[model samples]
Target: MSATDPPPKRRASIGARRNPASQAAILAAARAVLAEQGYSGFSIDAVSRRAGAGKPTIYRWWKSRAELLIEVYAAEKGALRAATTGNLAEDLTAYTAALWDFWRDTPSGRTFRALVAEAQHDETALEALRGKFLPERLQDVRALFGAAVARGEIAAAEVEMRLALYVGFNWYYVLTDRLVDGRAAIPAAMRLVAASLRD
Candidate 1:
């Protein structure tokens, strides 16, 4: 405690301080890494280097790589609005076409595909997808179907099945990388769906 004694260095904080700039940097870096390296090569170390932040800093904010990946996917995906054409068939076709284009042309698609792949082996990611992401997405689809029911274009009872069919159809194309080729089938599919609903 002597005056001549060197002052002890302040202990480093127990965990990384939640710096907005740092977090934004990390997220931006994560997006870049995912876009460039994809999910297979994405890692804490890679993001740490890209963001100029340390591993501990990244880990302090995101518990795992899968968690970070999910965040990146969610942030990039944002909110998608369902098309509201008066005709149910037109609305469904437009909505599906927009979705296919979004997936095929944007980083969000790859990010989501990675998230789906990660969820297969990571429970945290799976929970996020099943419990959070998927539900949010389904709501948009539900709105579209709800509108059809209100218009009497489809019975209320048919909404659930249509939702499942619509989601499954889009997911199949996304996972198979068939969006471009599948575009042609959308009109036929929507016509069939609309016909069934009307019947």
Candidate 2:
């Protein structure tokens, strides 16, 4: 009440402290919309309606629909992390198998494929795909490869080249009708990939 007293502390901006519940709702609604309608019908408006959150709230967390989709994919995929077992072949086998299962079995897997399709002509979407999503995933693979090299299981010079080959092999399955039918073939694929990278 004193004149010298500062005004009561103002509440911090909503943007400063994001509610986990709001994020969960938005992401869940995003996945549901993406699943039911695919990328063609996904929008901030649709998600806001479904999540009971405002458009500004969604935008506060994500810059664009594609960025939001990336979060949904990451959430569904969970960290893209793998533990190195000090054996290159074993490590590659496990990572490859897990990656394959993700793209082959999950709804978000299909949503990712649809996003890939959408990105072919949409520049913003493609930028998000290449600049954000792919780099995030590549970093994980790079770490896995780095660990193998540290243990002297694979050569130092082959990491990037090997990563391309590994990802391209899986991408081929995403583009073809070879995913499920190709599961039986992954161990062989991993062996070949490991052998190619071995000193």
Candidate 3:
């Protein structure tokens, strides 16, 4: 208790000494399993095996496959990043391109497709996909357009329809494999959306 003696040095709290290398390994393994086996075949046991970590370790970090999948999707999608270049058209074009690429080019897109198929029969999976994943992307889009409203390029009242137009067009192209030229379609789509909202 002497003043000269350092007051009991505080020890790191329990579970505070997480191994970043281990965590990265688990995430990387999870992504690999997701890509190889897909959402339908994905399992904690498989991820643990692929990760060289035990079930306890995976459970400590994520309680459910859905939880882990959220992280996987976020890591892959870069969290659906949005842009605000002040020019609404350009911003929308960029956002659209990013979204398109994420859905078209990434393994996460295949995982998402599998999730969609699973959701048709699994209520819990459907809830997670609908409640968490879709809304996150939608909110990002909303923010992008909200900026347009603030700048007076788009009417505040038209934000909803504007969002629908952009989403619908993108979905149509992705689903139907029509108009593979996103470069041409993106700018044309932006102009159409702008014309609709022009005051």
The lDDT per prediction is 0.75, 0.78, 0.73
Tens digit per residue, CA lDDT, model 3, 62-139: 756876787788788876778788887887888888777777677776566556666689887777777887777688
**Which of the two, 2 or 3, has more TM-score?**
2
How well does candidate 1 score on lDDT at residue 197?
A: 36
Off by over 4 Å in 3: 1-23, 56-63, 177-183, 196-199
- What order do candidates take by TM-score, descending? 2, 1, 3
User: Clashes in model 2: which pairs?
Assistant: none
Using all chains and alpha carbons, the TM-scores for the candidates as numbered come to: 0.76, 0.82, 0.72
> Where does candidate 1 have its weakest 10-residue lDDT segment?
7-16
Which segments of candidate 1 are over 4 A away from where they belong?
1-19, 52-63, 196-199
Provide the lDDT at 123 for model 2.
Answer: 94
Q: After superposition, how far is residue 143 of candidate 1 from its true place, in Å?
A: 1.9
Q: Write the per-residue lDDT of candidate 1 for residues 1-199, one digit (tens) a residue.
A: 2358664332233365677777777898888887787778888988877776778877887777877776776676665578788788888888888777777777766667767777899898888788767886677668877888888788988877877777777778778878889899998888766665332
- lDDT rank order: 2, 1, 3
User: RMSDs, each prediction?
Assistant: 7.9, 8.9, 10.0
Itemize residue pairs with steric clashes in candidate 1: none
